[model samples]
Target: MKPRPLDGITVISLEHAVAAPFASRQLADLGARVIKVERPGVGDFARAYDTRVKGEASHFVWTNRSKESLTLDLKNPDALAVLMDLLKNADVLLQNLAPGAAARMGLSFEALHEKHPRLIVCDISGYGDNGPYRD
Candidate 1:
């Protein structure tokens, strides 16, 4: 069989709610290696949004299918170190965290550009990263 377009691509996704996860799922469908980063124990809050499908959140399943998941408490130094290590080799970094959250943690494009010059960073937010409504 022929290799898919994104066969060797790796995506690190720090996402929740809907948009980012859905986008990454599409990438995963196209054969990217999508590693979804979740909170240590609670995971994505959407997991509790519904249990309509035999005790599982249909939304979560739909948005997260075909991807690997990892638990990382970004607050922990070791966990942050691990994320940094992943970024060093990742092809894309996709996140939909609250505005400025990723930047505060130094995951912003400007922050990672010099080190991972080829890494593609995608930040999805309902509102733009700046302005009064960007919370």
Candidate 2:
């Protein structure tokens, strides 16, 4: 088999809907280990968007393929600690959470840089990090 460019890279994704998950799926396609962190219970809300594909949400299935899924309730300290531990070996952290949510959870670039200096942090937001429309 041909070697993939991202064979040794690992991506930890806290994402949903379309954009971020699709991006992570791309990384996974390139041979990265993409671990998708989803909310507990219902997982990504997009999973329930509609069951158009044999009892699965087409939107979620389209974007979330080729990745491993993990359920974590970030509001809980134990779950947060588990995520932080996972970051220890992750090469990238990708999130499309509401603006400031990741930072509030101590997953911001600034907050994590000290510990995971080599880890790349990607935050996807509709609006820029700061603006009247940011929410």
Candidate 3:
């Protein structure tokens, strides 16, 4: 047996669509533990894109395998606390939320870097963090 490079890494992803999930899926494939955070009761929007895979969304099935899924409403204090606890030990935090979404939730790299110095925060957005068109 061989040891994978990411065998002990823990990835916590605040993702909804394809891009972030795709990236995290690759990490999981490399042996990282990927935990996907979704909205409670709603889950990921992509989950309802279509019922092409035996009642499961094809896109969801494709990128969500080999990972754990957790439902939490970031707006809820309790839920946010739970997520914060998870981040305490996570090696990476990957999010492809809407522009400014993560920042609005206080998940910006700068904010988290202070607490989790070693945490890698990857924010994927169509537009860069700041600029006239960052909306």
Candidate 4:
């Protein structure tokens, strides 16, 4: 099989549940580095959606292989600072948050791009970022 085109990119994902996690994992399978950022204590909610696999959430293991997990509470100043430091080298930022969540945390594409001209941001939402249902 052909290696995927994103072989050298690094993806940082602020995601929960399913959609974004699935995509980011596929990226990692194809040689990308995926850093999954979750909140402290709770982690990704999907991790507890069920315990159907070896005492772990089936969804969690399936979409989180070959990736690094980091606990971050963006609302926390110290954590935000650490995340900002990481953006210094991130090639891509992938997020699937509730409406306006990214911007609320000051992690919007426009915000990050002002500093890193080459950083790519993909905002995943139940609805597209600016369509009906957008915040």
Candidate 5:
């Protein structure tokens, strides 16, 4: 058997829905410390989807584990600032926000790279960046 490559990395994800969280958790499975960020009041909406498995939302539990749960409203300036602080300590950043959201938030790989030169960023979306499906 071989060890997972991201053993010592820490992944911080600004996510909702599924895709990005799914990816970060895989990184966590390999020993990375993944943090899943969501809105404060409601948390991730997926948590309310259905309590099918022992009162747990299948989607939320599946993509989230061995990670910290951070609640931040990206739309708010203070919250965004807090997220920036979090980025300062992260080795990797993951997100699955809507089309243009990453760029709007300036959380794109290039933007983040300017500060954390060694940080790895991954943006997951239904469509590719600059694609026909983009909004």
Candidate 6:
């Protein structure tokens, strides 16, 4: 078989809800490694949407396939350290965290670009950064 285009790529996503997970699923389908970062103890809120898939949420099952899930509390120093280490070698960082959440965790493109120059950071939010609605 031929190698997939994204066979050697790695993506780390701090996501919730549908959009970001959907995007990461596409990358995973293309053969990239996707690591989903969720809140410890709670995991992704989407996981609780409904148990329509053999006791699993249908939406969660659809958008989370072919990826790995990692629970982390970004507020914790050790967890933050783990994330920073992961970012060191990650090809891409995709996050759809609540408004200003990523920035609060120092995961913004501007903050991470210097340390991980080649890292591609994609922030998906309803409001763009620095806009009047940006919270």
Taking every candidate in turn, the Cα RMSD to the unseen true structure, in Å, is: 1.4, 1.2, 1.9, 2.3, 2.4, 1.8
lDDT of 4 by residue, 1-135 (tens): 677877878888998888789889988988888999999999999899789988779879898888899999899899999988888888999989897888888888778888988998888776776876675
Model 3 C-alpha lDDT versus the unseen true structure: 0.92
User: Residues 13-45, candidate 5, lDDT per residue (tens digit)?
Assistant: 888777787788788988888888888899888
After superposition, the stretches of candidate 1 with alpha carbons farther than 4 Å from their true spots are 131-133
Off by over 4 Å in 4: 1-4, 129-135
As a TM-score, model 2 comes out at 0.94
| Model 2 regions more than 4 Å off | 131-133
lDDT of 3 by residue, 66-124 (tens): 99999999999899899999999999999988887888888989989999999999988
- Clash tally, candidates in order: 0, 0, 0, 0, 0, 0
Off by over 4 Å in 3: 126-135
Give the winner by TM-score. 2
Model 6 per-residue lDDT tens digits across residues 1-135: 789989999999998888799999999999999999999898999989999998879999999999999999999999999999999999999998877788888999999999999999998875666779876
lDDT of 2 by residue, 54-111 (tens): 8789999989888999999999999999999999999999999998899999999999
Looking at model 1, the pairs that clash are: none
TM-score: model 6 vs. ground truth = 0.92
Every candidate's lDDT: 0.94, 0.93, 0.92, 0.87, 0.84, 0.93
Give the CA lDDT, 0 to 100, for residue 103 in model 6.
89
Candidate 4 vs candidate 6: the TM-score winner is: 6
lDDT of 4: 0.87
Error of 1 at 59 (Å): 0.6
Please state the error at residue 116 of candidate 4 in Å.
Answer: 0.7
TM-scores, all candidates, are 0.93, 0.94, 0.91, 0.88, 0.86, 0.92
Clashes of 5: 0
